[model samples]
Target: MTKSPYFPQPAVASNVAITTEAIDITTLFANAQHATAGGIVLFSGTVRNHHAGMAVAYLEYEAFEPLALKQMQLIVNEACSKWSLSHAHCTHRIGKLAIGDSAIVVITAHAHRSQAYEANQYIMDRVKAEVPIWKNEFFTDGSSAWGNNTPPINSK
Candidate 1:
């Protein structure tokens, strides 16, 4: 297996590609404060082999690094302000990935299920709609296409 890009620590609660070869979901939950929270929502987006019934073999992703990171930070900042969310973090995978690899993970903590669920949805939705990240899909037929768009900034 390949080592993770995140080192000593996973990112703080924010929207971005996050990993903790040392810090993972369990670690996040452990670090999360146990308040009067009644619910927690976690969302994970993974690589699948089929899209629109076409067999996908793999995928390669690239990003306008500086801008993409900025947008991710923005997403988190927005979320922190929009709800009673206690803690939220978003992590996405970069570089080439095979089928079944995890592409993203979003976690939210709230005192109520509604807030957690809604915030989780908003985080993922906004991440896809605003982040300057692009994916090049590799098909079984030896073909590729830019996902969303090239430069990724177009989607933003």
Candidate 2:
């Protein structure tokens, strides 16, 4: 059987992938679980039907897969080190995606729930701000444009 593009071997804890297929959130959760893990957090970023009051038709994502995966791995490694995580896995979907589809998933396991939650959020933020993935939004008005990464208004 062919291995998932995300995790080629079971020995490694950090897993990252840039795929065209739908993300398997269950597999990511399982991969993030470890013997010493007391808590697990999973985050899924889904495509929505509306953006800035405009009706979104869909989204198209493109990335330099090699560079994207490398940057993702770096984010996971940083989160693991900062939180003393037991395991971490993340996957980002590329290509065309419909509304309500999961575009990305991040799973983190740690000895504490707080650590798991914080690390999961941190990893996602870094992925959004630092990863090379680019998203183009198609609006119902027959217009499309590339999306930019803007920090949340409350971001510190």
Candidate 3:
């Protein structure tokens, strides 16, 4: 059996797409913190300039609102089932965003480092893969690519 100092229990999750303020990371950490064990992992995705060799000047994000939120909830449910994560939360951003802007954030906690690490990866992978978010990549030459940004249908 794996040895973890703490055990992941239940968690509180939130899903939102906003154009304003960056995620309050401190709050997310506090939500995942538990007195049971130790370790907490936080993952953040940002808008970067360059995807698949395209000189991305900027990125515009959009979500199918209702479906997108539902899919995000599904991701959380999957993470809970797969990991001993005590708590988890995620947020995604939409609208116009320049390079360096925060795109998403996920925080997971467990009793040990490995659990935290694994769960963190699981959450990010699932969110990117399953959530029906869309991204438009604007190139420096004024070209753009638009399509579903979902990561994949399955991950083990």
Write candidate 3's Cα lDDT for 1-156 as tens digits: 884545455554533343346677777667666776478888888887777666889888887778878787777767766775676677888888889988888877767778778877987887777777778888899888784443334412
Per-model C-alpha RMSD: 9.8, 7.0, 5.5
Candidate number with the higher TM-score (1 or 2): 2
Which candidate tops lDDT? 2
- Our tally of clashes for model 2 stands at 0
Candidate 2 residue spans exceeding 4 A from truth: 1-12, 149-156
Comparing 1 and 2 on lDDT, the stronger one: 2
Candidate 3 clash pair list: 6-111, 8-86, 9-86, 128-151, 129-151, 129-152
Q: State the lDDT of candidate 1 residue by residue for 35-77, as single tens digits.
A: 6456778787878897655689998777777787788778776
* Model 3, position 145: C-alpha lDDT score: 75
Q: Predict model 3's lDDT versus the native.
A: 0.73
The digit string of per-residue lDDT tens for model 2 on 59-123 reads: 99999888889999988988877777778888999999999999999988877799889989999
Every model's TM-score: 0.77, 0.86, 0.79
Task: Work out how many backbone clashes candidate 3 has.
Answer: 6
Off by over 4 Å in 3: 1-8, 12-20, 147-156
| Alpha carbon RMSD to native, model 1 | 9.8
